[model samples]
Target: MEVSKKKPAAGVPAAKEPAPTLASGKYTFSKSEALRRYLSRKQARSGKRVSKAKRDEQKKKPKFVEKPFNKGTRIVSLKKRPNNYPCKNHSKPRSKVPKKHGATKVRKSLQPGTILILLAGVHRGKRVVLLKALKSGLLLVTGPYKINRVPIRRVHQKFVIATSTRLNIESVKIPDTINDAYFRRIREKRAKKAEGDIFAKKKKTYKVSATRKADQITVDKQLLRAIRPHPDRKILLNYLKSRFGLSTGQYPHTLKF
Candidate 1:
């Protein structure tokens, strides 16, 4: 910002205008007189915004320290508010464990490298490897989809069957499981990079045809054959046959993934 002090008539005092500081240098100048006014106004408006933001941020209540419970204490008495309850209402709902509904209890705990059969979802009954346990108590499993039928994704722990086979895959790092917010942030970042017509049009959707289905089966067979060892393939094949009567074609079968 530039400042101009107009000279007063002879023997009169010169007009006063302060010099621009380093921080308030974002002003646009068309004329010296306008520049001084613009900088002063802009600085004042910005300072007000900064102070308001800081004040609003400070207004948020901090998480209070949890104190030990004592029956004699007024805050902890059961007749009043208990020590376990929170003082403020949270915006998000608390997570709850689903009620047990006679679900089969597997004694084995799932671990990385564990091969599991998906008991539910689109890839039900297909074999997948547990890449890692997710933060949300779900299993991050993958079928190595390019080679196997199962696409990489997080699966509910309840819907997976822990198979006895555990292949060694500790060498690879599993990517983090993502939610909608993660993708939304990515889209916002990309939007900020360019303003108009920057994004490509969404691709069209299509229904699966018999030919696509046939091709998928062929791909799954080729991928499984190339990836799985002779012994492991034999076990998976036998399991599939026994579970679905694949050999006799007595039961309905689904697409591999």
Candidate 2:
């Protein structure tokens, strides 16, 4: 038999010599070591580096095999079955985030015209009449400002103590204009002043807007109309005017609001 020798092409390097084999016909170098040297030599001749991804693709990876307890058992190729046809979900995925500020439910004891005792804020311990519950879950209450100094304001239901005493305020019409949005104060864009000018200027007083004053007057008139004809009018007015407080030997649980 005659062996053929191929001539190397111009500008292209010749192939490397085959890896040395032992008498048993096995490579002297490990498969991985031989592959690494082959890639390095090929890269040097070509003057182009083999990318890690490309090198990894070219590398012969060992197949995963489960170890056998018995040496007599034949090596079987075990493959994970692909999920080509996955199980379909009949229900939608549950949302991770909850929606902000859903409408608050009204308490059974808290109703329109029910007098609530303020449990928090500057007006704490003052009695006020519940006009309605806002969409944001805040209760709309007023001091009638005539009976007490508590102005028409929004208070959380949790912060107010509901009384068994109820008034006939169904006749009073709450203006559609007065809602959660009504109480939101909009900041006016002011001209930027120098740091020195800020201190030089007199501290500005926060006066209630004209529209807010008008709204307060309008609501108060409606509330007063309902209160004027009540049979226990004098006592109710005195009760609202009084401040709620705990004295010596007095417990909240023992006393009813």
> For residues 1-257, what per-residue lDDT tens digits would candidate 1 score against the true structure?
88996667998887675654445575344478777777778978877435667778876645343445675423322234455965796689766977656533333558776777787887776777676664445676766564345655678887876766666554454333233222222222333444557456564465455643554454344435543664677665444333321445544344232
lDDT of 2 by residue, 48-144 (tens): 9867897798665555565666665454555566769778889988899987876779899999999999999999999999999888888999998
| lDDT (Cα atoms) of all candidates against the true structure | 0.57, 0.87
TM-score of 2: 0.60
Residue 21 miss distance in model 2 (angstroms): 53
TM-score of each: 0.34, 0.60
